[model samples]
Target: MIESGFAKNLTGQNLSSHLGPVSGKGDVRVGFFWTKVQLRTKNPALNGKIVNRLCIAKQPIGDRYTVSHAYISQQDAARLYPQEFGIFTQYETAPANGTPLSDIPGVSRSEIGLLELHAITCVEDLLSLHPDQVSQIGMAASRVYKVAKGWQDKKDENEEILTAADVQAKAEEAIKAMEERLARLEANNTRLQAENDVLRHSASGHPAQSAAVTTAVQAAAAPGDDAPYEFPDDDGFMAGGDVVTGNDDLSDMPDPMKD
Candidate 1:
């Protein structure tokens, strides 16, 4: 039974009376909380002393309001244990996130109630129950355990498949990025090589051309001793009177006759 009257924490505020009784028979949210309880002593020195106490807070199903008398005393908790087995389980073993017993496949209401009587409130609790404890639940304990185990196994397998797919996608993205980078690098290298070739051609072309021109000018200005000199006419013929042979002893040669 829940306490009726003002809660110990809030002065002159009747929380339990405002809200109806709280029980774990129905769906409710249960969580731990700290309550500030005011102490009243006969001695004047001990009067008005406030202390913090750890307790439970119960809210309606679907995350509704916090019901009255959310914080139940030890005596109230013990009395309500048979009705609110969840509270007793939370008080003793703090279970982690898990599927509710009612949600387990092939589990009936009577089986759930029986399991709760033994402080097994969730799927995790049932799966981890000792063989001895499971035997205590009756002949159908093994069947119920197998069903919960199957559900967990299937969930884990799905998670693994999703993880593998995610990993593969990331790897593909990384490979694509690396390939693009390599292509850019190759293009830059090719451009640099072309520029180098152009630079080499520009640097060597002028010097070679200038060298050929100098050689031709030197050959024309400084002829060999045996070289001949001649004057050409517009008809592509050498002028006969202007020809000078390399032999200096030409005094005996006959003079040209005027036409």
Candidate 2:
């Protein structure tokens, strides 16, 4: 039995008086109050008896109140074990964008009975259904499944599902092609650089060669200066030697014209 009370204070209220008298067959007695009261049980049958205590408080100043209560049961107390469950709502058909049935193109949302199939709640389940089974219900099951699985007949870049290996292979191929191209470009650059260096060296030497030729011509033009000439050593005669000023005693050739 449960009993509750509210008052300014516990001074005159008899706590035991509220409990009344126990009948002949009642095994346990129960009572609660804001103030403390003492009771005892010496019976072996009542030993280790469990009691639940509760205190409820209400608000609003003058209306503020507190009530104490206890629960007593004859059965042995047991711990409650909680289990989790999911609630699946059943519709006449599947929900739109919830489950697809076929892979056909241009299938309208209105035409597709998305809320019809039983035991098919997700797109994955829809994709796993057989075409014939879906056809029995007068729907394009295969097409719907394909669409749900993101497989379309047309070439859609977004719909392609490449495996890791396939992607890796394609990447490797692209890398190889790029490397080959880079190698060709590097080779071409190397060849061009070599040609440029050769051209630069030749251009640099041309000025020096021209200056030397001018100096030789000027020396030859000066009187008493050596003539610009060349002679084969094996030919005893001064076959190719010519004096610019024509004042040469062959043995008096200037050092510039010698050897």
Candidate 3:
């Protein structure tokens, strides 16, 4: 199985180089926030290489915890110390903001992991992610691509908050413009509908006129009693006090007003 390792100094180191020597038990106190070294063996092939690196440490405190080379596996610590109070490498550290990527000694930028990059909590973490991976998590590809290219979010440095009166004025102007356009379209539609009704009334009278003309031409072309022209009743054709009659031999016909 894959295993993880971490190393911490049980005893605190001397701070003499930075400050003068203390008399008795020393002023520096061992604390939880002291530096820690960690190593991981995700696969078996890297186990021996990791173990050998941890066995050579002469001292386990001070600048030792600060260097990346001080991290080692449990197997090598057993071989080197073989006694009490040697390097006690464990499997994990308590959850906290990890060491910053910039402050991790001897580790290069390329060797950084997702967790390590997250510790930085900066644009560097965003840029390290692949574009496809970002897209898979439903983030915008262009935004991620811009981040990878070292782009920062746009900030309106000179922007000032608008007053309430300014916001109200802009809203009123927009509503007024929309209402005016709606009123103009309504007027145009009414005018077109009136014009269309007049045209339709005028067109209805032509069908009866065309039928009468056709009957007259037929009567003139025929000479014998064998030809008979049937005319429909004209009582249904009255409009605006005008009575329109169908075609007949009007030379001998009486006016309907006299009848």
Best lDDT goes to which candidate? 1
Alpha-carbon RMSD, each predicted model: 27.5, 33.0, 31.5
- Segments of candidate 2 deviating more than 4 angstroms: 1-139, 142-164, 204-259
Give the true-structure RMSD of model 1: 27.5
- Candidate No. with top TM-score: 1
TM-score of each: 0.28, 0.23, 0.20
Please, what are the lDDT tens digits per residue for candidate 3 over residues 1-259?
9788886773597664554432433222211112333444333233212111222334224332322324545565566454521324332232233224434334345433443333423344545677676555443333434533442223122223334545565566667767888999999999999999998888676988877888788878874565654434575543256566775535356655555
Candidate 3's C-alpha runs over 4 A off are 1-162, 210-259
> Candidate 2 vs candidate 3: which has greater TM-score?
2
Q: What would you estimate as the lDDT of candidate 3?
A: 0.47
lDDT of 2: 0.47
The order of the candidates by lDDT, greatest first, is 1, 2, 3
Which 10 consecutive positions of candidate 3 have the poorest summed lDDT?
Answer: 25-34
lDDT of each structure?
0.67, 0.47, 0.47
